[model samples]
Target: MTGAASISRLVKKSFLGAYLEDALTLFEAGSFLAVIHQPDAYALAGTAGPAAHEDLLQRFADGVIPAPHTRELAVEGVVFGWLVLDTPSHAEASALDFVARSLREIISRELLRRGLGAETLEQYREVALLQRAVGKLNGSLDVYQVAHSLLDECMATSFPADHALVLFLDDASRTYRIVQSAGSRELPYAERIAQSRLFSEVLANACWDDADGEDTLASERMVKGEIVNDLTRDPRWDVDVPEVSRMLIVPLATSRIIHGALVMASGPSSRPFGSGHLKQTTTLATVTGIAMANAHHFHQVQRILMSLIQSIATAIDSRDTLTSGHSQRVARIAHSLARAVSQDRREFPDFAFTEMELQEIFYAGLLHDVGKIGVREEVLTKATRLHPRKLELIGMRLELWGAMHQREWTDLFERLQAINSAYDVSEEDEALLYRLANKSIAIGEATIEVLSADELSEFLTPRGNLNAEEWEEIKRHPAESHRILENIPFTSHFPRILQIIVQHHERLDGSGYPAGLEGDELLLQSRILAVADVYDSLRRDRHYKKALSQEMALAILEQEGRLNKLDARVVRVLTGALESVEHAEAPEPRAFGLGSPVDHP
Candidate 1:
């Protein structure tokens, strides 16, 4: 077959046929087309003689392709091999040279497409990581928790470092203070590294400095909104470090305000951070700033809610004169006892009140007597057996009976005297006078008995003169309180607050109401409230009796504990707390937080 027609037919049968045909159209003497195997370079298929193909493959494998070589064939962005001319220097070779250049353009396009695909995938991965970090940052309401989580996320996302310092800018101090840190578990120096004066100075300088040209990228990121990856070269970082060490400083800031900065450092022999690390660190800082802002707002809302609750408690207390300031005193006592118990867990085993649980107890104490609002004013104010009005009615009935019998008693007295003879009388007359006098006395005594029945019954009663039915109504107040509280929605923060309140009056022996929950059934907080409530009640006068001295009240509490009417552990703790309160001066009321002393008033 002639060279052109033979080649055309061969191209039609092979996979390379289409490429070869189009390539040969530009030249009379057909050029060789083949695929190159990389690394161990060799031509898979070719139209040239074996000698020429071997020479081309050797040159490609040696990393040296001759000048004026045929076009490189690429598939899927990989250099496959060359499409070479069979007859070089011929007039057609010149035309075919252009063909090689066109093939090269096609390969270049494929390489560019592959590169773009890789970049797209990398971007997607970064976005996913960023979203995950942001989620972690916004998850907590506490400032320290947000800061710790921010540092954790940064380290998790490829910013490997042996040590890190998280500083928050105190607007009042106008300086950054280290709030949290992570890593460096083994070295004692590492533990104190973040607290070191040198470290503090560096961070402080970085935070306060403006974006002057002399400032290093580390400090300027705060002002210029950039990132610093190399602490070694940054003039802003004044610390002396080993040649192998590196650091990254990212500003914790948003568009509105700058919160702080995160300083991350890798020790000697550790890998240094690069541009990609700096980008992710910057993203983490941004997320952290948002989280901090959200946390601050969250705390503000919490403070407002606390104030609202306190107001409600105060309003509830104001409903009755007898219970004035009762709720506040009970809450303070409850808080103090709880703190005492927490400090000595060994003494009070199987009872550990977490921070949230303690808060629930405090709130429960403040609202424990809220149920009294449902009680009638007369019932609440009843200070004696038989209300005064009832006693007055009894007194009026007695006076009417006395007036009606007055004439009868006078006539009897006259008849008796007539029997005794108008003046000095005989023995019989005298005896008759004595008998009539005795009869009159008996009659008067009988009448008096009849009139005093209601008064005597009430006066003889030990507690308040509420009849059985009236007392039962008073007993239902706790349940009413529970019902009222149930209507108000509570969040997960106080899961068992209502339960504690409702069950506060329940005794260990099941003698107390409303549900009569006994030992082990009642919560620790319920027992605590019960003790605090009873202690305060005894310390203050009620409608039934005068207030008991603190020592007497404590003794009664101890008696109840012995009788199984109250929690013994709670009683003991509370007694100690009361003693402490009696001796110690009143302290300033402190906001609730760990390590703060309990408020006594």
Candidate 2:
């Protein structure tokens, strides 16, 4: 045997060490090589009877045999050790190195064959990152918070790395700073300056700039082998430390542009970087880049949505100067109450929607009253307890009645004058007339304070023969809101939420208003909106009434809950969220990534 044969013998020896019985049985079963189950794992002459042996011999006549890499192939009553290794493909047998390469290739092909390619794995990883970011966002989980979490995962996965830094490219479009860091890395102000310059000069310029496109590679200011690693070095590694000098800088790029970068380094004990390793690093970078971009994008989208919502809330407040802070105040209370329920580990298992979802809910609450924009101002701003036009009509009728009373009194006074008792009769009649006028004034005054919206509209409408023509008004504000929203293209994608806005006034007991939806018939968002809207209305100063204190507003809601007006559990959430909103400030979105610093009114 030559060197090749010796190598083959060594391979076979190690193979047998792991599976002696398998090799021996295959050698023994070569006699029966026909009509065997080819893929069976445990087939050999030792396991078969005489009659099956004949079938194995018949299969041996054909050129095919057991697969080379995997055995246990059955030839009726026999198995073979690699199916005789004989090949009719004379072309393949002619090359020695070709055969070795073929074997190596087979092992590498397994993952691809199983549908787990490098790209596929990377995709799965991206999805996982997206899920985490979204969860944090929904939990009102901060964007940087999610990045820190991802860094923790990375650190936990790679133990020996003494340092790590994750930077998110915020909207300044030129700057990216330390989002999360661990170990001895002294983040340099210079690096951030350089990073900004690079982003502005390279990434920002390359992306969306007419000269650069998706194919543009991000330019690193401190290029991996030089500037950055030196600045962020571990104190223990000295110049004599040739053992600890490996650096890996991988640019995280995606379909659109260069999203970010991941820098991984190790001191001496770490293996030298190789092509395979570079590919792995690049893969991770690409994934991280896409994730950062997506997280940033998702957050901005939320803020954009919130801004629109807040604008609506602000608009509602602006309409009634007295109730300027109403909706926002409600949102604050509701969110605070919700956190109270969600923060405690004993009671809060896991908030399902996450930070972003909570924000969406908060935004929706602020916009719930936007539809009231369509309501008539006279009705909304009605003061002194009576509708303006109806009060004028009442005044005219009273004047006519007073005229009739005066005529009768004058007649009685004349009759008394004739009997010389007119003065006494006139005095009694005067008193009686004064009492009737006072009684009428008291009725109008009493009803004005407690009269509800619908009741006010009814009472003011001249009733009976004395009033004007038949009076009626459509009272469903939700449907009206839906109609109004249906016309605003800015809120197109949010149709369901718009619907919730419309139906927000609905009651679970079918006693609320408008649609009167019950139980699950109402959306969770709508349920949350109901409490927030109600709270804001109560807390904010209004045209017709005074703003109640936060505590008083909450008490009103609690009472409404017992009465089965608003959902009890939802009110509980709002009550808990009260302080969160009161002291709660929306994080300046501009600070994170928006083009400018977001200013709140």
> TM-scores across all candidates?
0.40, 0.36
Model 1: per-residue Cα lDDT over 77-195, one tens digit each: 44545565544444455665676566556556645644554554355335445546655777886879988898777656556677676777789976677788776542233333334
User: Across residues 436-548, which tens digit of lDDT does each residue of candidate 2 receive?
Assistant: 33433234445322223332243333221111222112245567556544432223234355766676787777876676677778876676677767777776655435678
Native-to-model Cα distance after best TM-score fit, residue 48 in candidate 2, in Å: 99
The local distance difference test score of model 2 is 0.46
Q: How good is model 1 by TM-score?
A: 0.40
Candidate 2 ranges beyond 4 A from true positions:
1-309, 344-351, 406-457, 460-475, 484-496, 573-577, 587-601
| lDDT for position 354 in model 2 | 49
Error of 1 at 580 (Å): 3.0
The lDDT for every candidate, in the order shown, is 0.60, 0.46
